[model samples]
Target chain A: MDRLGTVAVVGVGLIGGSIGLALRARGLAAEVVGVGRDLASLQQARERGVIDRATTDLSRGVAEADVVVVCTPVGRIAEDVRHAAELAPRSALITDAGSTKRGIVEAVERSSPRAAEMYVAAHPLAGSERSGSAFARADLYQDRVCVLTPTARTASDRLRRAREFWAGLGCRIVEMGPAEHDEVVAYTSHLPHALAASLAAAVPADWHPLAAGAFRDGTRVAGADTELWTAIFRDNRGPLMNAVAKLQDRLSSLKYALMNDDEESIRRWWSDARARRLLFEAQQPPEA
Target chain B: MDRLGTVAVVGVGLIGGSIGLALRARGLAAEVVGVGRDLASLQQARERGVIDRATTDLSRGVAEADVVVVCTPVGRIAEDVRHAAELAPRSALITDAGSTKRGIVEAVERSSPRAAEMYVAAHPLAGSERSGSAFARADLYQDRVCVLTPTARTASDRLRRAREFWAGLGCRIVEMGPAEHDEVVAYTSHLPHALAASLAAAVPADWHPLAAGAFRDGTRVAGADTELWTAIFRDNRGPLMNAVAKLQDRLSSLKYALMNDDEESIRRWWSDARARRLLFEAQQPPEA
Candidate 1:
C-alpha cells in the first residue's frame, strides 16, 4: 500500500479524529496532521494518538500535505474546505465527510471553481450520536458505505483519488448525483433525526420514568449535539421538509387506521414496514 | 424465602416465559405451569425450562394454581384473566402484563365483577420488541418499573399481592389509575411504536441501504409484531391519537423554523429536547 504523505484533517472532532486514527493505524498515512480552530481540542486529539501532529494554524497544518480531509460541522465544512484548498498544495486532493453534499459543492464552486474541481464531495455514511475525539474509533468507517456526489464539473482524477482515500479506510464507494444524494439521505438520515427529536420532545418532562426501551431507542439520536444538527436541518431544509411531509402522511394513515379501528389497514401498513425492515437489515454489512 | 406454590402463566410468550424463568431461577415458584392455546409453543417453553409444566387447557392449568399470571396480548388479556379467575383457587391473585389497562379493566368488570376484583391489571414496562420464549430472559424485569393500574373496584389485598408478585421478579412497582396508565403509556410506549412504524414505512425500499444508525434506531420498534401492535394501537386509540397530535406540533415547529431558515428556533427546540434527554438518561436505572 502506498502511504499518503502528510495527510491533513481539518476540524478534528469525531469524524476527523476517526479519519486520523484509521489512516495512522492502517499505515495509509505517513504523517497525520490535525487542523482545527480549537487548540485545546487539537491537543486532546494529539494526546489520544488520533493524530501525529496538531496545529491551530490551518496554512501551516496543510502546507506540505498530499491530501486534506475536511471533517468539520456541516455549517463550517464548505468554508473549511475552501480554506484548506487555499492553504494546501495545488496538487492536493481535498474531500469532506459532511452529511449533506449539495450545498457544500455549490458553495465551493461559487467561491472558487478551481477549488471545487480539486475537492471531492464525499459523504462517508458512518456517524454516531456521540461526537468529539474521545469517542473516535479506528474502525468507525470499516465496511461502511461512502457516497461520492460528483457533478458535471467534478474532476475525474480527484474523484478517483477520493475513492482511493475512503477505500483505504475500508469503505465501499457509491457514486450519486449531488441532488439525488441529498434527497436519498433526507429520507434515510435527516428525516429519522427530526422524527427522533420530535418524539423525544413530545414526551412530557414529568413522565420520563414511564418511558422504556421503545422510547429510549426512538430518542437515542435526540441526545446528539444540537448546534450541529440545527445547521444540518437548516442547510438541507427543502429536502428535509419534503421528508417530514412524507413522514406526516405515513403517521396520518396510521392514526386514521387507529381512529376508525381499521385493523386491516393497520396490519397492512406494518406488514409493508416489516418487509422493508427485513430487507434493509439484510443489506446492512456486518460490523468489522 | 417462601415459595409461591403452583404459579399458572397463561399465554406464555416472552413476558410469561420471562416471568416463569425469573420465578424458577429465584426458587420463588414451586411450579410454573404455562397455559396457551398453542400446545406446541407451551411444550417448547417447558422444554426450555421457562415453565415446569405445559397445558393447552386453561382451566386444567389454573385449576389448583395458587396464583395466575395472564401474560397475553392486549386484545386477549381481559378474556384470559376472566377465565383464569373462574378456574384458579379462590385465593389466587390474577395479574396481567397487558400494555393497555383501561379497556381490559373495564371489560373484565363488565364480564364478571368478581373476576375484575381478582384481576390486578399490571403493565410490566420491560418488554423487548423480540417476542416468544426464545427471547425470554430471567433478568428481563430486573430494576424495571412494573405499573399496577388499580381502580376503585380493585381489591386492596389482591393489589398488595400483585405488587409482591412483580417485586419477586425484581420490578419496581408504581401505582396508577387504569385510565392514567393507558394515557401515560400512550405517550411513552404506544406513540413511539406508531412513530417508528410510520417513519420506517415512509422510507423507500430501494433506498434501504442508505439508512444508517439514526434511521435504524428511529425505526427499531417497527420490527415488533404487526398484529400485536395493531391491537395495542386500537386498545389505546384515543390517548395514542393525542400523543400523535403533540408529536405533529413538535415537528411542525421544526418545519416552520427550517422553512424560514430560523437557526435560532431550531437551536431553541433542540436545546429543550437535549435538556430532557440528559435528565431522563441520568434517571435510568443501571441494568443488573
Candidate 2:
C-alpha cells in the first residue's frame, strides 16, 4: 500500500484516536493530525502518541491531509465531512466512521458537491462499551469488518483509496450501498442495542442480583454512550424502525407459540434460532 | 454443615452431573448416585467421578438416598419429582432444578401430596450454551444465584435442607415464592432468550460476516438447546408473556422516539438504560 502523506482524524474520541494510533503505529501516514472541539482531548491524543499534531480547527487540521477520516458522533459527521472537503485539496480522499450512512451521505451531497464526489461513507463494525481518547487502542480495527457505503457521486479513485486505506489498517473491506448499509446495520447493530436497552429497563431492580452471564451478555451494549447512541437511533430511524418491526414480529410469534402451548412451533422456532446462531459462530473469524 | 449421605441425582445431564460433581468434589455427599434414562450417560457420569453409582431404574437408584435432586427436562420435572418422592426414602429431602417453578410446583402439589411436602422447587441461575454430562464442571454453581421457590405445602425442614444443600455447593440461596420466581426469571432469563432468538432470526444471512462482539454477545443465548428452552417458555407462559409485553412496550417507546426524531426523549431513554445497566454491573458478584 502507498503510504499516506498526511492523515487527519476528526473528533479525537475513541474511534478517531484509535485510527490515529493505528496509522502512526503502522507507519501508514507520514503525519497524523488530531482534530476535535475539546482541546484537552486533542492534547491527550498527541501526548499518547495517537497523533503527531493537535488542532481545534477541523478545516485547518485537515487542510494538508492526503486522507481525512471524520470520526465525529453520527449527528456531527456530515458537517465535519463538509468542512474537511472545503479545506482539504480536491485529491485528498474523505471518509467517515459514522454508524449510519444514508443520512451522512445525503447531507454531504446536498451541502458539498465536491466533497460528495470525494467522500466514501464507512462504518467500522467494531467498538467497546468504553469511550473517549483515553481508552483508544492501536489494534482496535484489526481483522474487523469495515463497511464502505459509496454513493453514485463517489469517484472510483476516491472509493478505491478509501477501501485500501481501511484495508491497510487490517480491516476487511465490505462494499455496500448507503441504504443497504443502513438497513443491514439497523438489524445487526442498532436493533440489538435497542433490545439490550429495553431488556435492561424491563427487568425489575430486585432481579439484578440474580442476573447471570446471560443477562450480562445480553445487556452489554446498553452500557454504550447515551448521546452517541441517541444520535445513531435518530439518524437511522427509518431502517431501525423497520428492523424493530421485524424483530417484534419474530418475538410475537414466539410469544404466540408459548401462549398457545404449541410445542412443535416453539421447538421449530428455537431450533431455527439455534441453527442460525451456530452458523454465525462457525463463520466468525478465529478470535484474535 | 452435615454431609449429605447418598445423594441421588436424576437425569445426569449438565445440571445434574454438575450437582453430583460439586457434591463429591466438596465432600458434601458421602455417596452420589446417578439416575438417567440413558445408560451411556450414567456410565460416563460414574467413570468421570460425577457419581459413585449409576442406574437406569429411578426407584432402585434413589431408594436409599437422603437427598434426591430431580434434574430432568423442565417438561418432565413434575413427573420426575413425583417418581422421586415415591421411590426415595421417606426421610429424603426432594428437590428439582427446573427453570420455571410455578408449573412444576403446582403439578407436584396436585399429583403427589407427599412429594409436595418434601419437594423444594429450585433453579440455579447458571448454565452454558453447551449441554449434557460432558460439559459438567465442579464449580458450575459457585457464587451463582440459586432461587428456592417453596410453596405452603413445602415443609420447613425440607426447605432448610434444600437451602443448606445449595449453600454447601457454594451457591447463594435466594428464597422467593414460586410465582415471584417465575415472574422475575421470566424478565431476566426467558425474555432475554426470546429476544436473542428473535434477533438471530431477523438478521440476513449475509450479515453474519459483519457481526462484531455486540452481535455475538447479544445472540449468545440463541445457541442454547431448543427442546430445553421450548419447555421453559411453555412452562412459564403467563409470566414470560407478561415480560415480553413489558419489553415490547419499552421497545415501542424507543421506536416512537426515533421515528419522531425526538432527540431529547431518545437521549433520556438511552441515559436511563445506560444507568440501569451500570448499576446492574456494579451489583453483580465478581466474575468467576
Tens digits of lDDT, candidate 2, B171-244: 89999999988888888899989989888888877888767787889999999998899899998899988999
Error of 2 at B82 (Å): 1.2
Worst 10-residue lDDT window, candidate 2 chain B: B279-288
What are the chain A TM-scores of the candidates, in order? 0.97, 0.97
- Please give the range of 10 consecutive residues that has the lowest summed lDDT in model 2 chain A: A204-213
Best by lDDT: 2
What value does the interface RMSD of model 2 take? 0.8
lDDT of 1: 0.88
Per-model TM-score of chain B: 0.97, 0.98
Listed in order, the DockQ scores are 0.80, 0.82
The clash numbers for all candidates, in the given order, read 0, 0
